[model samples]
Every structure is written in structure tokens, then in C-alpha cells.
Target chain A: MPNATVAGITVDRNDEGFFTDPNQWTEAMAPELARSEGIDELTDDHWRVLKFMRSEYAQKGTGPTVRVLGKTSGVSIKELYQLFPKGPAKTAAKIAGIPKPRGCI
Target chain B: MTSRIVILGGGTGGTLTANRLRRLYGADEAAITVVDQDDRHVYQPGLLFVPFGLAHTDDIVRPRARQLHEGIEFIESAIDHVDIEAGEVRLGNGVTLGYDVLVVATGARLVPEETEGLLGPAWMDSVFTFYTPEGAAALGAALATFDRGRLVVNVVDMPIKCPVAPLEFCFLADWYFTERGIRDRVQITYATPLDGAFTKPIAAAQLGGMLNARGIEIVTEFNTGEVVPGGRLTGYDGREVQFDLAVVIPLHGGATYVGRSPGLGDELDFVPTDEHTLQSKAASNIFVIGDAANVPASKAGSVTHFEGETLVDNVRRFLTGEPLEAGFDGHANCFIETGFHKALLIDFNYDTEPVPGHYPSPVGLPLLKESRLNHLGKLLFQSVYWHGLLPGRDLPGLGSNMPTAGKHLPVPEKD
Candidate 1:
């Protein structure tokens, strides 16, 4: 039930920093979240992937799979790996201010 | 009147051994009964993936009794003791079943509490092990938020199941963090008691080189003493390593019941057997497989697969009053999953160490080298276990005896 304050915004986060409630996420917090993830800035490509993840989670209630990330987000798999080095699906889900992606990576 | 073969522990070792022996001996010839404390048979290799979120517990578990062939009777109950001399096993519920041939395949037991301060303050909160399903699942949550700081994979002791598993965790961690774009923020370290990254000298050199190239630090000969505060792991000799999150493989011991069956096991309760022939030194009629056998082989599933053929062949010889064949050769192989869709495999035996070569055939999958194709093979092994291995079907090209056709054995220097 813990929450984190980032970019002057309050949002619920677990000890591991995963969102306790996905609905609490805000687009304005993405940059600060990116900074926390060690990315100083989120470029157009990063936003493209992050937006796709957030939108999919909002619509279908599940994050995008890593397999379809590059194709759907218009980013190459190689480039996607470079964009989200921790893992495209899990890391992007975290930075997008959504719940941690589930299932086998 | 049929001979009863009571296999203790319905694990990889017991399941395959029972199935293979069942196929060799019909219902009239031998009756196979597998006894275990629980009916859940876990695909232990998948435990490594659970923490990384690459696998689900449901996907890896199956009813142990269901996995057994129709002929093999499965007893889902606790084992009070094994009357090895009396040739019968007593279940916790007071039932006794005698056996002409008893296979001690209970496998290894993880003794996490054996380590100091491991089960203390930080247990499962920060110090998690992927050896068990609960541990793996707990670590999965921990790994999700673990971004920066030292992520240490420590092997507290040796002779553990899947000896290379801890090393694999380190490699996968690197991959996991690298993908998150915060790889630079996190540091990876593999602290082990062994002299190098691996046991075999040849494979160790290559694997050690890989760890070095990946910027993963290797701390050798570290005998872990305790888990101190602030994520510092102190060794017995006062050496220390710090980690924000620690993945530790605890000490292993033989099944507790082995201690009850006097003279049936080693000091650690692991059955002492011929490394070449899995026949227990305690008794000729008793055989051992997988983690149960104190053979100089890896405690991996591949070892049990290889041991199956030899075990069944020996069972036939035993029943017919023939000498057991020493064909096992301590053959063992495992696929090391590296990050970035790549994996490395190593195959070796008692005398030979894993070196650069193609496995199975000279042109087969590359050995002692990392590749994506090998990664595919690693992923494919799960289905192979369910469909082929547990059923006792021999894989084509791959057999019990290790093949040397394409293996690059180093040449000895002449004086």
C-alpha cells in the first residue's frame, strides 16, 4: 500500500517500485519515471513504445507482448532491445507507469 | 507372484526409472511402485525461469502419479523410513511394501536454514532462492523492482542440483537488466566456492572467459559464512560481497530418510554408488539415480536421462543373475542460458571434460560455444522432457553413453 512521489505527482508503488494501482499513472510522470530508470530523456521512439504499452493495457487490460512490441510499435527488435535494455515488455511496462507485465518473458 | 520394484521419490529419477523398468518387465515379471511425500513433480529446471518471469509454476508442475505409466503404482504419502535390509519401505500411514529391487531416487533436499542469517531478517524479502517454486515465485516479484545495485547470485555450497544453474541466473540477470535499459545501473557478481566458474577445467575456462567478457565479476573459493545487514555476504574466511538483492542456492543434503537407513548413504545421506554403475554400495539389489546417487556427475536432469538406459539395462542383468554394466560413464550435459536469445551447451563424461565440439554428431549443435540455435534447443527441452524423457523413449543420436565423434578432446603434449 506504499506510494512514491515523483515529478511533484503522488502515485502508489510497491517496495520494488511497481505500480500498486495502474490507474494512478499520469503521462506527465513518464519523464521522471524515465529518469528513475536511468534514462535521462524519453525520445519519440521510447514514447512510441511506452504509449503502445499503456494504451494496450488500458484497452485490453494486459500489456503488449514482447514478441509483438517491435512490429506494433514500429521499432525493430534490435532497436527495441536498445530502448528498453532491462527487457522491452517488463521495463517498458514499468516506465509507462503501468503494472508489471506478467507471464514468461 | 511378481517381483515388486519400489522406487522411492517420484521425481525425475524415480519417474523415468520406474517407466523404463516397467517397459522392460511386464506386469507378470515386475511390479513398479513409486512412493513420494507429495504427488507434485516439478520440472526443476524451470524453477530458474520463474524468478525471471520466463515461466509459470503451473506450466512446470504435473501430478507425479499421472506422469507414471499405468502399470506403476504411485503412493502419495510421507515416507517414515526405508527398511533397506528388510527390503521393504514403510509409509507414514503404517503401510509397508517390500521390494526385490529398491531405487533410492528421492533426490536432494535444499537446506536453506543450514546457512547462517540466510533465513533471518531478509529471507525471501531480499535474499531469495530459485531452487523451490515458492522461492522462485517470491524472487520474481523482487526481480521486478530490482533496478540498480549489486545483484549477487551466490552458491552457498556445492553438490547442489543443476550445478550450473546459479551461473545461468547470473547470465540471465545480465540479460534481464540489459533489456531494462538500466543494466549500467546494476552490477552482477557470481560468488561461488569452486575455483572457477565451473567444475570441469576445459568448460570452466570457456565459461570463465564469457563471464569476464560480460563484465560479470567472479569471486572464487568463497565459502559463504553469513548474510550480514546492508546486503553484505561474508564468507567463512572473512571475505565479503554486497548486493541489494541476493539469489542464493543453499546447501544440499540427501533425503532425511536416507539417514534412517543406516549405511545406505554417505555422510550427507547421498547414496554411495559406483560412478560407472548406479548400483548402491550398500546393497546389490538397490540402485540409485539423479540427485540421490553420490556419483561424480552433475545433479542435473540430463544425468538421470542418461542413467535411465543404464539403470534399466542393469535391472535386467540383475534379475537374470548377470553382472551390472558400468556404462553410465558419469555422462551429463546442460544448456547454459545466456542473455540476448543465446545459450551455450556442454557435454562431458567422467574422464573427458567439455571442450569445443559439436554434440551428438560432429555436425550437430555446437558445444562449448554460445548460439541462438542452442537457445532454441534449450527451450525445446521442456517438451522433450514431458513427451520423450519421462516415457523412457531414447532420443535419436543422443544416448546414455556419450559420443566422442565430433568432440574436440585436447591432445596431450608428448614429452
Candidate 2:
């Protein structure tokens, strides 16, 4: 598998499967990767947005625009930007492992 | 040359700070300029209630540029870098904005792909998150079709915006599924990396008891490793839980621009901010607030509200060559939804945890205990958020410092 490193952190191409298949992205794997990235804790707002992004992709087949995504998640656009400054399309897709998103790239 | 104040983001912190400054300083004294890539301003707290159909997506959004005071100039561009020594901010558009003072409120970012397999094929199929309006609507649709099986809500990592929201989702989900008459068919699970449901022990005990009473499964210290497709979550310990639908909270980091700005932020992009002063450790001229500051307080709207007062004062101090006010008490308050038409309220700061008592005064709304009044307070805050919070108006009796008068003191145990 081709490997990529972001800011010195190694990311394997096989890791793509981690987000692609719901069955493969297990709770056990999330923290290991997070720890490697140096994230030590999980907050409820983080889960709310991540879970919402997945559902949005499921029903709409695409991530919501930053505006819509923020509203749906109950996070104001200011707050959403505060939470995901890259915008919802990129951040949500990245976390959901859905690709760079069509318009974002 | 005109004295310049450069704000890195046009979100809550930037908007409020600019407006408040515009109110505090004459336009000629300080040329306030706010930079952001887009003009869309979202009502963030509304996202949590969207999936449950309590709020419409359109109701919570507005143009970013419109929210600012008349004197503030909005620059629509992404920040390429901040040259702190030169006292200038370089934009992606090639413009250099020089400033006498700067506010770094670019805030945090969510990176779900940081987790292995989280962004894969089944991302939106059986897995979801509601931090966005689109995610909420999609979750609403997914929940509509879900008839039965295990439903798990997991948090990947912390320091996210609104620390109580996921718990609210769990509580509301219980109400949502029950209303659909499919509550029994859906087994609800709450998983976290913490040893308890929350960080604060006292609040965790209270909330943990409520979850237990609701028959919702609580899986503590379950650090997630990956999301196995087909609804199973694998933990760091190799233990796996199967689910029909999985909700995930991904890892969050500070804005990318923070990394671009030398010595401005941490390895994770969060700014090395003074907890008490809200000033960036890298430079005295730079200040931070909201989700961007790496303070050990709950990253909620109330924290920003509290920080706003102290931050404004400190900025004033910085301009006047006065001693920077080290007055921020890490005060953070939030409303916790407990389902079945009730909610709980808690207020605390750095040295204190949430305790059961009345807030503001000894006889006011109950705190650290469930009541309908708190639930109404949560609902009312939405309106207050739009009208009161974003506008930089001070909420009556609710200031930056947490009032200790009405809170119940921790009971001492016999040694």
C-alpha cells in the first residue's frame, strides 16, 4: 500500500478502508491513530459533528456545505468555523473518509 | 499611520471582539479589519438540535460580513501566514495587512480522517455525526429508516466545541427513538475515552446515573482504534462492539493557518495561550479566545462569553500600556439535557467542579440537578445566542466569572 505522511505522521493507504467501510472503522482503531496524531481527549461537540457528517453523507450522498452543515449540527457558522476552519465539506469528508470532496479540491 | 487591529478570523471571537472594540474605540483611533475566506456566519449551537428536527437549517445561518458593526472592514480571504515580528498578516490573496495589535481567533478544526478507516466507504451509510447541519439532516433521515439494532455514539478525542452536546444527542436520541416507537429495537451505547461519561467527576456521576436509569449502555475508557464497516467499532484493547448504526466524534485540531504562523500555535495547531490572560505565549501583542485557545476549560459558548469580557478588557489594557488583567477564572457553564422533558445546569471554572445548587443566587434555577427549568433555559439560550451572544451584549447577571454564591459546596468526608 502506498503510504503518505502529513507533518511527519505516517498514513498508510490501507487506512482508507478504515473510513470507507463502517464495519472496519472500529472504536479500537480510532484512538490509536488519534494518539499517534497526539490528540488525547474526545469532546461531545466533536462527536456531534462527526456523526452528523456521516449521516449527511448517507442521506444526501454528499457532505453539506459549511452553512447547511453548521445549522444542522446546531453549531453556528461562527462556531462551526471555530470548530472546523477548513469548512464543513473538507473537514466532514476528511473525518468521514469520503475523499477530498468534489468542489473543495 | 493609523493604529491597526487585525483579527485573523471572522467568526464569533473575531466578530464580537471587533464589534466590542468598535463600541469601545473610535474608528480613527484603531482601524479594525477582520479577515475570513467566506462571509457565511452560522448559528452553531443550533446544529445539535437539527437532527432531531427542533431547528431548520436555514434558521441558523447568516452572512458573516453582515454581523459586524458598521466600522469594521471585512476582508474575504484566507490567511496565508502571520508575520508577528513584522506586525503584518499575509493573505492568500497576496495582500499584507499590517497591524498594531492582532487577535488570533481562527479557532479549532475537526479532522476525522485522523482516525483510521473513519472516512472510508461506509462513512455516511451506517456511520454519522451531527456537528453540521447537513450531518444533522442526514442523521434525521437515517434515523427515520432505522428499525432496530445497536446504535453507538463515540467521541474520538476532545477540546471540541460544546462539550455537553454529545450527551445531549444521547439524551435526545433516547427521546427520538422512543417517539418513533423503535426505542426497544435500537440498543443505545455511549462510548468515551474517559474513565467516566465526562471529565468532571461530580457531573459525570450525576450524568452517569441518568444514563444508567435510561437503560443506555455506557462504555468507559474505550479508546477507539477504527470503525469497522458494517457497524462494528474496534477499541484500542482489541475489544469490538457491533452496531447497526455508528455515530463518531473525530479528532479536532487548531486551524491550519496557525501552523503557518511561526510560534503562534502548538504542534496540534492550538495556540499556546495564557489561561488567565488569554494572550498568546508566542507574542504579547497577540490574543486568542474561543476554541482556538488551549485553556483547560470546557470549550463551550459560555466560555467564549466569559473570555469575551476578559479578552476585551485585556486588549484595552494592552493598548493603554496598562498591566494586562489576569482575571479570567476559567469560568464555564453549560446546560445538560437529561431527556424526558428535563435538563441540568452546571457552572464551574479551573479550581471548581460542578456542584448541586442554585445559580446566580441561592434561590434561582437549580444547578447540578435535573429540572424542567434548566431544559427551558437550554431552549431559551438558542434565541439568546442569536440576539444576545453574537451581538456582544452582556447577559443579565451572567458575567465572565462564575458566581459561587448559590452553588453547593463539596461535602467533606470524615478522615
Candidate 3:
């Protein structure tokens, strides 16, 4: 784990740069994190998915899977990919400052 | 009148809980009954070995009723729905059983139909899953004749029982082919939805390395959306992994009864449970165990065995009007069978990731490394599961909580 300053706020992150603690994330940091993940801007659609990911992580210990986010996040699966290219659920979770959704080891 | 306790499912968790509870209460105090649709209780772990011709259906399957203690009752009937408000479990046969405490151990159900085209024309002929007796037997026949081609093992989604089995299948397949002198002909690939070979970082790196050394390709973060008839797994993200033969671990959900009984389960039909207490969020009188509870631990048999101690104690306390003990720590111990009579053991809990060490005691079985001793331990566990674990007898040096004495803690890296 390592601490890095993003958007002028320090936060703890894992080796893959995912947040070790979800509470360290703030709205101000979303844009910079989004930028790092290749998103030039945080659109209203991006925020919707990110907010959903954060809230779901708050409820469940882990983040939601793509199927889960597509079903419940009010974002169509196609649009989710449009919002966050490649892996929507995983990439969105990265921007939202949450650990990647995982299977139990 | 004796307090009636009805347990759902006659599988691992249900059998152990009923037997354990019977030991705690006299027949005059608590009348324990375990119910399932059929009398067959399959040693689920043996299913992993079935495809490799190491075990047979007869070797794993046993009568569910035979495992229960003398005082415990066993009923073979389909669970229709649970009326939580009325405190009754309605059977498909039109019988109603009332209970003061309901232990929901009805484990995870395989939903192969959930995935698009998974059960298509190519099913069984080329695309196979070894999760069930029928599936395993069919796969065994298929693998016997499978001489050359790319063999892909794909895990459709998460929360599956025995998450390590697919990886084990890959390792065993490599050995199985090598033994048949077709190792060079058959190409093996492991595709999973997770970001790595495993969920944990360290274990993922280690397992990933093993797969590489064995010449098995790993495709990570690939969520299977559709399985084309001839031979391709199309990801939702439009990536594809082609295979000549595919062994798929389909999506899993809680038993259908959970979906029928409103307010009983979550969106996925798993009972929302207290991770520490094993008590269902549905009601105070209902307790959940094994894969049925949406806990963060691996849905392995070792997890159910570890949960048994805390769950039984909590059930006793809940019935006697005592405060329930939040004793369960999501301890899960699993043995990953690599090829050639070698296996890797991992012991972990909710807070701790598995590291190199020994389990149960400092001198006990080695952990997080492959060895012949762990393979023997894996084989010997079948007997332990039947004679010891299912009967609810406590094993010396092994308890509900994870032991820390033998485990080597990772040194903290300076920031």
C-alpha cells in the first residue's frame, strides 16, 4: 500500500492504485483519478456511475460487478462502456476510488 | 412441548449444524429436523476430481439421512417457500413444518441458463461444466477422448462454491494430458472475471506464476457474455477467447426458494447476513451459513466447517434468550490441487490474506506453497469430511477462529 496526493489530497491506495479505504475519496479527486484512467473529463454520466460504485461499496464490503452495475446503476451497459472505456465496472471503480470487485479467494 | 428446529437442506452445513445442535440439546428439549429434496449428499469437493477419473459418483455420493445422528430427523422433500411471518416452511409435497428456529443452509444453485448460449447445442459435446455429478461424469468421458485442441476453463462470474476448483482443473488437465503423452498437443487457458489469477494479490501472483510455468494462458477481467456454439467466449466488452473445448463454471445463485420467499434474500437471492454473527438480516430467528450467506469469504467447504462452530453456538444462545455471540470471523481454509500429487494450502479470514505458514499449529500442514504433503492432506480430507466433520466432532488444535501462531506475518514496508 502507498499514499499518493491526488487533487491535492493524500489517500491510501493498493499496488494497482485502487483505494484501500473508500472514505479517503472525495468529489474533488474524481477528476484527477478519471484523468489518470484516460478519461479527459468527468461528465454527469461518469459521476452517476462513480457515485453508484461508491455507494454500493459502502453497502457491500466489495464493489459491484458489471452485471450488477448495469442492472442497478440506471446506466445501460452500452452507455457504461461509452462512459468508461474497456472495463466499465472495473475502470469506473478505479475512478470512484474503490477496490476492484473480486471473487473470494 | 419440545422446541422444534427445522433446518433447510441436508447438505454440508445443514447436516453438521443439525448434528452439532443435537449434541447440545436433548430430544426432550429440541427436536431437530433436516430437509432436502433428495437423499443424495455428494461430497462436493470430489466433483473436482471426477473429470480427471480420480473419483467416481459412487465414491462421493452418500445417503443424506445416514449422516445425521440418531436423534436428528431427516426429511426428503422439495422446499416450496418459506413463510417467515408464520414461522413455517411449506414443502412441495403439501406438508407444512413449523419451527422456532430456522437454519437456512440451502446452498448456492447453478444457473447455467443465465449465461447466453451456455446450454446451447455445443453443451456437453464440447462445452462442459464439472460442478455436478452428471456434468463431471460427462466431462470425464469427453476428456478421455479429447486428444488435441485448445482447452479453455472459464469462470462466468463470482461467488461460486469452491472458487479454486477451476484453477485446480487446469493444473490437473496439464498433468492428465502429460500422462497421456498429449501435453504438447493440448493448449490450456484459464479465463476469469477477476483482475488476476486469484482474488488475493499475493496468491494471484503466485498462482499466475504457476500457470505461466505450466504453459497455461490466463485471461483476466474477461466477463463472459456469450458462448458461441462452435467455440468462442465473447466478453461483454467485445473481447473474445476462442477454444476448441470449454469447461465453464456457470453463474451461481441462492436456492430458488430464496427468490420465492420475499424479504428473505438479496438481489442475487443470497441471504444478507451478519458477517460476524452468521445471523440472517431477514429475521432474528433465522441463521444462514455456507454459500447461502452473502459473506466476503470463499464459498468453500472449509469455510462452512469453520462457520459451524460460531453458528451452532450463536443458534444455541439465540434460542435460550441469551445474547448471540459474534464469533465467526469468516475463516476459510482451502487446498488447491496442483498436478502430479502436489497441492497448495491457504488459510485466511475476513481481515487477513493468506501468507506462507503452517495451519492448525506451527508444525501442522504447510500453507501457501505446493507440496506432496498437502496433496495427501487433500485426499485424506474426504474421510475426515465424512467421519469427522459431518458428524460435528471437534478436531484437536482446530477451532472456529483462525490461528495466528504458525502464520508468518508480512513485514511492513516503509512509506
Point to the candidate with the largest DockQ. 3
* Per-model DockQ against the true two-chain complex: 0.01, 0.02, 0.52
Q: Judging by DockQ, tell me the better candidate of 1 and 2.
A: 2
* Highest TM-score model number: 3
Write the residue-wise lDDT of candidate 1 on B242-335 in tens digits. Answer: 9999999998888998988877876567887887878998999999998888777888899899999988888789878998898888788889
Give all candidates' CA lDDT scores: 0.84, 0.77, 0.90
| Order by lDDT, highest first | 3, 1, 2
Residue-wise C-alpha lDDT for candidate 1, range A30-91, written one tens digit per residue: 88888888788899999989988889788746676454464367886557767876557767
* Chain B TM-score against the true chain B, each candidate: 0.98, 0.97, 0.98
The candidate that achieves the highest lDDT relative to the unseen native structure: 3
Q: Locate the minimum summed-lDDT window of 10 residues in model 2 chain B.
A: B406-415
Query: How many clashing residue pairs, candidate 3?
Result: 0
Candidate 3 lDDT by residue in tens digits, A21-41: 888888899889888988999
- Local accuracy of candidate 2 as per-residue lDDT tens digits, B55-138: 888888888898898989999998898998998999999999988889988777888887778988878888888877777778
